[model samples]
Target: MSNLAILPILLPFLAGVLVAFFHKNLIASRIFSIIATVIHLALTIFIFMSVQESGTYVLEVGGWEAPFGIVIVADPLSALLTMTTAVVATAAVIYAPKSLSRIQEEFYFYSFFFLLIAGVNGAFLTGDLFNLFVFFEVLLMASYGLIVLGNGKAQLRESLKYILINLFSSMLFVTTISFLYSVIGTVNMAQAAERVGEVEQQGVLTVIGILLFFVFATKAAVFPLYYWLPSSYTVPNAVVSALFGALLTKVGVYSILRTFTLIFNYEVDLTHTLFIYLAMFTMIFGVIGALSTNNVKLIIAYNVIPAVGFMLMGIGIFTETSIAGSIYYLVHDMIIKAVLFLLIGAVTYAAGTSDLKKMGGLIHHYPVLGWMFFLSTLVLAGIPPFSGFIGKLLLLQGGLNQEEILIVIVALISSLGILFSMIRIFIGGFWGEADIMDLPKQKPSLAAMTWPVGILLSLSILLGVGAEMFYPAVSSIAEYVMDPELYIESVLKE
Candidate 1:
């Protein structure tokens, strides 16, 4: 069963390679991509369930020992995220055939999509830090192909900015990894942790930890560094935007969460405190960007930053409950963000524009889209009895328990800011007069596009409504992440 770990990464890469040659038979390509995604989702679910039952499973390549061979570890956290990634990718694929431009469809869009997802799963499951860097490159190259499929002025411009920044980060990442290897003698994460404990995290190692975090933060779209994301994501089509918005940045955050908790925490007083302040500012600046935007895509893109901050809030507090809350929140945001972007696509399809000022009274014509968009705002804002609430409650509780009063207040205010920013979209886009000029001449098949939105929405509802059922598992994941020794021991086979 442990051997099944490679399939999630390998299956998609093979499917993508196979699909690449089917350029002429688009109908055949769609079928193949859909089948591939469905299987990927199933594989991830099986791995998730197996990990829940069996604890972590580490697969070392080439039958070599840990620290000497490359290893893939399907721990509780990675398994859950990979499962969630598959779920989101499946929905994106289902919604894509009719939604993308003809040029995008004519090219190997789904092929690049598969490659990106394979890289994402590899990032989550790899136990080696250098392999993590390799996986980042894999996903990024795939994303570049996806972005350039647009070939429009905006897409080209934004994609250039997006690429340049990631390239800079990648260079810095390799340099930092080289420095880390020199000091620690291995890039196997477990070995790095073991060696860090032996040397005690101080002086040059602390510099390496912060430098490494800086690289991940850039990828995660933490503030100051996040200026690139809103513009870059907004320029892509809805499905691409949804995938980038919902999952890519989360990978960066996942890297941060894994590293800070596992290998970079000896100076918590300095490090975690920096996390709190940065998170606080991230939430503030992110919502400001969201509220100021009238472009529907821009609003959604900016909101992604605040969600990143919210997850970091849980991490900065560094409590078991807070970590649990962050994980729950992270999962919830991934689904809701996907739902929101898919709806953005539907809305623009019906309205023929992304500007909210030119849009009006969509509910009168498209009740399902309007209503779902409205409900999604509630979920995004963490209103009661929905998916976003429980994780937020736990985070807030954890903050108060630690007597971190100021940051907690900022988080609360930021939550309200988020609700207000999203409601503006609902009110402006769905509630006004039906402007005849704004409606598309040929009304889109809202039904075709929205089924994916509906599937993800139901999952979001389940997550919130079933929070108690999920509590024990989430807590265990929190425990698993908080203990560096467990990760080190399992990966080292000690």
Candidate 2:
């Protein structure tokens, strides 16, 4: 169990170093990454099984006691996220060869990829707040390299903006940590949770909380801080974009969830209300952007902002069911969004453009891709019998239980907006008229791309159909997150 707790992080770090040293040999680097990710996945599975049997596990790094030495903690929530990270990383790795150019491949892309995985795993498992900040830097530095690997005009322009925005956020993150450490006198998350209330700095804590919020909100692409996302992300290859799409913003969301639930519950009434308003605005603005965009990738990127809003709404409502629904929706959105982005990439690869007006009659030639996109669209729209539907159902029920009528209305309206924008894509991009004589012909080899999309789609379907099983797991996670004592006691004994 102890090994399970650490291997998810260790395997990737070791592999990343090995890949970086052997960067000149692409084949060997790829093989090392693949093996490392597979091992990481196995470790996550083992940890999941252990958690299922024992509830949670804690590992004191270097065999030192907690509150003094570093610790890694795995409860249901972190374990589940770790598992999701593994699955998405595996799929992105598979999709990379087709998406990355040979020049990009020579730049140690695989090493950075594994390092990103390692960072995410560390973020999910670490029991220390300072370690979380370290992991965020690790991931951000790797992402910066990946985004600029091509060094094209577009890549450089976007990378500069990306680095600037993320740098500001990182500064805020460090400041927040400094304040937190000063207040609690410990960086261990469990100990901090235990000691935070004892501090006589309510006003300072509130200030720090707001600072932390700004840091994460930027990373999560919440409105007003979201402009950098669409342009920056569009410059990367489809695989990198898909990976960032699947995992990066969610890291911020996870931090918000962890901190708010564990260490800052005292400010819930204030913060939760603020979150509710931000969520409503975020959804409205994101959908409007999606509706206005003609670029397929940009549309998807804009839609992601609203998806985060939906999850935030669940958090703002502050109910057991609502938080559980948020968890479910997060997992659902990550898989579906990755599949959608990859599908768009495949279309761009095939048609040599992402402009909706320039694409048409794709359904006739690429029925498989069409059907996959259609199914994903339905899932995104929260259509019945899909993963999105179940999540929305739970969220709405929680809102109703809390008498948050305005939020309920806003949620439904935003969902309709998703449906409407997706329809625009379907009609104009896939099914609309195409000049058959003028369209350039190319051999369709979307088979390799289909595998990742298929895996994602299958998982979405399974989650929806197996809701009975998943709900319990989600509920358990929500309970664990809402009460930090369970986590603290496991990691730091009295």
Candidate 3:
């Protein structure tokens, strides 16, 4: 079981190497990528089941002792995240051939895609802080390649901005790790958590904590640091945008969750207060951006920025229920966001434009695509019987439990904003007079592209309807995360 933890990371890395060398054939590359994703998904499920039966599993890598060599750990939180990453990556791979340019299909797209998966898997599974940083860079490097792969002027310009911002953040990340190492004398997250309280200077720890928060905030597209996301993500192809929309910021959020729960719990009250305010502001700002944007993709991009705030709000509330809500919402947002982006991508492919102002009456011609878009948009807006509704209810319940009146009000406002923006897209893009003449005579392959999206939408519905099962799972994860002594003991013990 301990050995199984490594497969998710290793499989993608190995597959990437093979694809980079020998699988230049698009068919072979696609098959290999799909096979790799399927195996990773299966391994993730097995890991989740193992955790369900026996609790968290810990493996000291290379048979070396923990706190000296690297370790891989799979608590419920890590397992759930790994599973989510695998599912999303698989869906993206399955959907890509239909969406990617023929050049991209033949070149480095599959290789880089698998590398991105490996990086995400590494980030989730690593029990060491420095290892997390390494994985983050790996993901970023691959993203840089993908963003610039098409070589359009817009792609080049936006990719440069994205690369520069991320590079700066990477530098800050290195500084934070150096300071953490200087203070704790170890990069092992479990050890850091154990010793963080005993560090000589509380001020230093606080400063480091804030710096690290900023680093993640930038990566996660939080308020004041999110300006680059919409513009940059808009430059990529729909398939790339959909994958990034689903996974990238979630990785940052995941890092923040892990770091806060494990390493920076020394000043919970302060961190909680700060994150709460940030969450409120992020949600407000992101919704406003969505409201003002005319481009459908940009609206989705802006919406992604604020969703982080909602998740962070749960983390800030810090009750058992809030933490559980945050976990559930994290998974929920990942799927819904991906589905929406893919739908938008399909819409753009059909219309040759992303501007809602230029699109109209698609429902009359492309009923399947229109309804898919409508359903996904509704789900994203937190309509009932959808995953978003369940997540929002849990988060709102947590806010009420804490008597956080301001947060409750802000959350309500955000929901309204989401609904309005979604309505704007639906009414303008799908419900007006038929503008089918401007669109391509030949539609993209709906069956190939739509099925993966259908799978994601189904999962979202299943998560919402099967809340009885999921809530217990989330609660168990929250409990494990909040108390992590068992994780520490398992990893460090002889």
- The alpha-carbon deviation from the true structure for residue 2 of candidate 2, after best TM-score superposition, in angstroms, is 1.8
User: Against the true structure, what is each candidate's TM-score?
Assistant: 0.99, 0.96, 0.97
Better of 1 and 2 by lDDT: 1
Per-residue accuracy of model 2 over 1-494 as CA lDDT, tens digit each: 56578888888888888888878787876777777777777878888878978877888888899989999888888899988888888777877777888889879899889888889888888888889889999999999989998889999998999999999989888888998887768888888777765662377787887788888899999877888988887778988888888899998888888877787777777888788888888899999999998998888888889998988888888888889888999899888888888888988887778888778888777788888888899999899888999999988998999998998999999999999998888887678555532455666588888887788788888888888888888888887777778877888776
- The local distance difference test score of each candidate is 0.91, 0.85, 0.86
- Model 3, range 374-491, lDDT digits (tens) per residue? 8877788788878788888888999999898899899888988988998888888888888544766665557788889899888888888888878888888888888857677878
Shift of residue 285 alpha carbon in model 3, Å: 0.6
- Top candidate, metric lDDT: 1
Q: How close is candidate 3 to the true structure, as a TM-score?
A: 0.97
Write model 1 residue lDDT over 45-120, tens digit each, in one string: 9999999998889898889999999999999999999999999999999999768977898788988999999999
Off by over 4 Å in 1: 436-442
Q: For each candidate, C-alpha RMSD in Å? A: 1.0, 1.6, 1.5
| Candidate 1 RMSD to the correct structure | 1.0
**Preferred candidate (lDDT higher): 1 or 3:** 1
